[model samples]
Target chain A: MSRVGIRELAAELGMSISTVSRAMNARSDVSAATRERVTAAAERLGYRPNQSGRTLRRGATGTVALVIQTNTARTEMGETFYFNLCDGLQQTLATRSLDLVVLPVGASADRDRFLVNAVDRHLADAYIVSNTDRTDRRIEYLTQRAVPFVTLGRGGAADHAWLDLDFEGVAAHSVARLAGLGHERIALASDDRDINSTWEYACGYRRALAEHELPADGGWEIRVPDTPEGGTVLADRLLDMSPRPTAVVLAQETLAIGLYRRLREAGVEPGRDLAVVGFRKNPVCDYLVPSLTSFEVSLVDYGRRLGEIVIGLLTASPDDEPVHEVWEMTVVPGESDAHPPCEKAAG
Target chain B: MSRVGIRELAAELGMSISTVSRAMNARSDVSAATRERVTAAAERLGYRPNQSGRTLRRGATGTVALVIQTNTARTEMGETFYFNLCDGLQQTLATRSLDLVVLPVGASADRDRFLVNAVDRHLADAYIVSNTDRTDRRIEYLTQRAVPFVTLGRGGAADHAWLDLDFEGVAAHSVARLAGLGHERIALASDDRDINSTWEYACGYRRALAEHELPADGGWEIRVPDTPEGGTVLADRLLDMSPRPTAVVLAQETLAIGLYRRLREAGVEPGRDLAVVGFRKNPVCDYLVPSLTSFEVSLVDYGRRLGEIVIGLLTASPDDEPVHEVWEMTVVPGESDAHPPCEKAAG
Candidate 1:
């Protein structure tokens, strides 16, 4: 955008090009007074180095590759969450002239050959991992190559730079909200993506039970695929329980939606027969006979934070501390959870 | 993905490389029979022209850039319709081995420069328009240069391939649906960005009303921005009408959401006091106090169709006829529409 070079800036300021270059690169040889003069001249001239040449000279391209795995069925790739995060990421990266390469990163075919061939081959400065599991080959390869990278959710360990939603708080809040309505029996339709998000949220549910001094029932956890069909299957299985869950806290909206359809087919009223809550208050949830109560995460903000981290990683020295960002979730209460166990409520 | 060469195929088929090359290029000297034989062998051997040499030779890369405009306030980029359209576009183009260069075409500094300048400099073969309007300069400049282009939606009278949604069908359906529910008086909320869609739909609405023997009333069309606050303003204006509309159809989900909120605050239930329907259903719409009924369009399919057209144009002769495509919209019924007025049912 700035179409001016350092030589033009130096010429305008009556300063030697070498002195200006050193100031721009932050060299110690130039005195502070001269550095200020050089900086001001560069700023006034609106100088921007040729991006391609600068990136080539430097070791990285200052661009990050967002590798969304589309090999196996991925929850993030197929859902609204993926787009919102990318949208948020664009908001953050577009400002810094950084571009996101949205390529299917899975090695399902020759794409895998491209990913493992070389990080430098892709000309990316850093890698951003999404929809990957605890032992993903892509993350393992990136770490081995010593390339800067960030993950949306935890990838194996907490050592890498990441920004994750508060999975625990969501479970805790659901429990509190349901208990306040005098509901004793609660169940969870946990997401089956990476064990990380599901495990964390399940762990949080246990923690909340301990904090509230409530019993942790074995009937609560149902590990199901992160699709509406999977939720329907889980719902069928739950109905076989000695005392079916009075309230359900499904980890994703697709599950909640599937549950609604299955329940309707079974001639059951949602708000009256069962109370439900889920993550990702998906927009379609409210259109169900009884809407779902769920938590809303800002994917745009998440992507923006990821962008900031990538930009920071791109411009900062290799030794600069990695940036870590964490955003919480907001609860969106819907009609599905508006009823109590004793009597269904009407507004 | 095949990465096989024509020369390699020629060697395997025991044919002269020059003859094979001539056949592949469709040279007039090569007989039709020979050309068919050569093409069959090439397909069998999975021979694709070397992209590097082709890119250098024609000054055109077999890549179409999709420039999506990102505004600060527009965060619902993950809307279901966009994903579906993009998916559709990708699916159609994948067969041709053409790549879609996805980038956020936003304003840098105060000036909005189309990244067309970036693509025009031998970066891509064509430009695929996404989320562009009638006053777009991209259409004008690209047309002057005679570049192969396609649009998801039309902008003015540009000579390019395009695939647009049937807004007229959407409008007709909304009216017919309301009429089936016995709604006589109605109002409409139209989004500013979706003028073309609004225009077609409005005409359809009028046509449908005339067919139903319902008279059009003045002060029934409410202009609104695509936001919750805009919905609020439109709702206020519509509610204050001398003979208030029993139903409303909106061009945007945010506006419909605002209307639902406004009605709730004024102690009016959505289905009881005002029936509502919207286009461009956002993720948060289902959770709105009354889930919105609306039209659904697939953005992924739209993107895919545009991609396919670009590939077709690029691979064909220079005088190839531009391809025209239009995707249909289906109704997504929610809780907004009520049967025979909720007050009458209550009585």
Candidate 2:
């Protein structure tokens, strides 16, 4: 006879596996009635606890959710990222028996409908919110609903639990690196994929400029989409400005690649005429003719941490304090950002 | 006060939520002994049917697993493929509250583990094996165990539920395309990442060669790891062969990209330099300096079909025959290949 599994049982029971496992594990907090029924079935079916089963039953689902924009907008963490993150999450969660569920929101999707429909059903215990913005409707809904969720970057407000890179801090570091190169007149190649992401980055750039005593000129910030083509177009636009900036910090890796193409087209070598830095490195980094200097984020670790926090939030008592976590980021140097000729700063 | 969700109640019950929901929904199959216990307690707590509770326990978990190998070798799906599959699966399962579970098998993990650890322990009804190959460990395991499963792209000799691309027929088509291009000495580029995947493509190439009354020469098959660098390394070696191949059919996209780079470096252009064709129209196909011509398998449809099969298996009688599905493959033309000037004798 085919072994009866959760699907059949759940269908017969009219409940979720998370609920069934939770009750069967005798999580203590499960209601007296649920405990009674679950205990009876375990007795009847002789369902004993196994490793994955035990963990699955744990209030922590060993599962985390990465909420990002539509498929097209995503440049980093391509198919490989999803595969690898789940691979890594399963590696860690399997020892305890966890899984990863990826949820994508349509560009034209209703944020509230997506979150409530996608997440509120509570398949995953906790969630990892990626590519977040300041006025993220989903985050706000989650907050009001009091769902335990984590953000990949800083949210509009700082109250939620998140694992984020310090946009301002990274910007400051970039400015410092560029300042040391003796390039005063600099252009900013930015990607406005989302208002929120752009805003976080712009805020950081502004702070860095204020600290370095550089002019916060209008032309200095050239906003565009985050892609190679976008970068190329933006590069040409920046170059057309008379007395063009000598250095640039390309906010997106694809944009950075575009910058390289544009520079080459204009007979401007990256190292000699246009010292540059990029954010979020992708493959073909070293393979690029000049290679690219960019910042790196550990997506695998990010996924694992999200699993931990989400599971914690799901299992924790409603009254329990919100769990918040901070993640670290680092900068990687490459040929693109090498010092050109030194020049006076534009104050 | 925050209402106690079904998961919380079920966790307390020492039983799976399916049982609880079944007991609540009052499915006649459940023993009175179980029902009385669940109802009495549910009534005691004023527990009403939560939408998630209703949907989750009512039918299939609306969750399906996309199982792929996690070890040294990887035959995975592309971003478009993965998301398209999800989109298709979601369209069918969403109204019923289904979710997709991305299952990456680690070195120690096997197909059975998914059943015991994932299906039995956690809350999944069925699994879709992505990157299935001849004599696949997971497919064999799933078939033998009578577990609900479906395959995409590749399949095993075993007769079970599966959705596959017509690789053998496609190879014949590829032969016809090359023949039309007036190419006599054709070569094949096979990835060494996974022997099963490479073998499948190799077999197809052989079939096509045989159909066209072509010889499978020693220099015809070149094996390399599935990477651009591997392609680059193989290109020089291929070019050095005494009887160089006039045309090449690459089994991987990354390898094709590598070949492109090598050809460019050697002062050769793709279509003009050497007629080349490849499987898997990858993400950057359009963006390539010259767009690549390759096959586009209906991954989303494949996933959706698998989801349906699993749902059927879960809901149908145990004695039902395994549903078999063979998906179609499409060939897209790019600047890669041309036909032979004269007609060749058919096999």
Q: Tell me what fraction of the real C-alpha contacts between chains A and B each candidate also makes.
A: 0.10, 0.22
lDDT of 1 by residue, B148-247 (tens): 6677676567467665677666777888898888888867777766435666667878888887777688578778776557878887887687667888
* Error at A290, model 1, angstroms: 9.5
Docking class of 1: incorrect
User: B239-298 in candidate 2: lDDT tens per residue?
Assistant: 676566767887766677678788788766666657777776665444455667787665
- Report the lDDT tens digits of candidate 2 across residue range A266-347: 7777766777787755554435667777776555554554454455454444344554443445688888878664333211
lDDT agreement of model 2 with the native: 0.62
State each candidate's chain A TM-score: 0.75, 0.73
Worst 10 residues of 1 chain A by lDDT: A49-58
Worst 10 residues of 1 chain B by lDDT: B50-59
TM-score of chain B of 2: 0.71
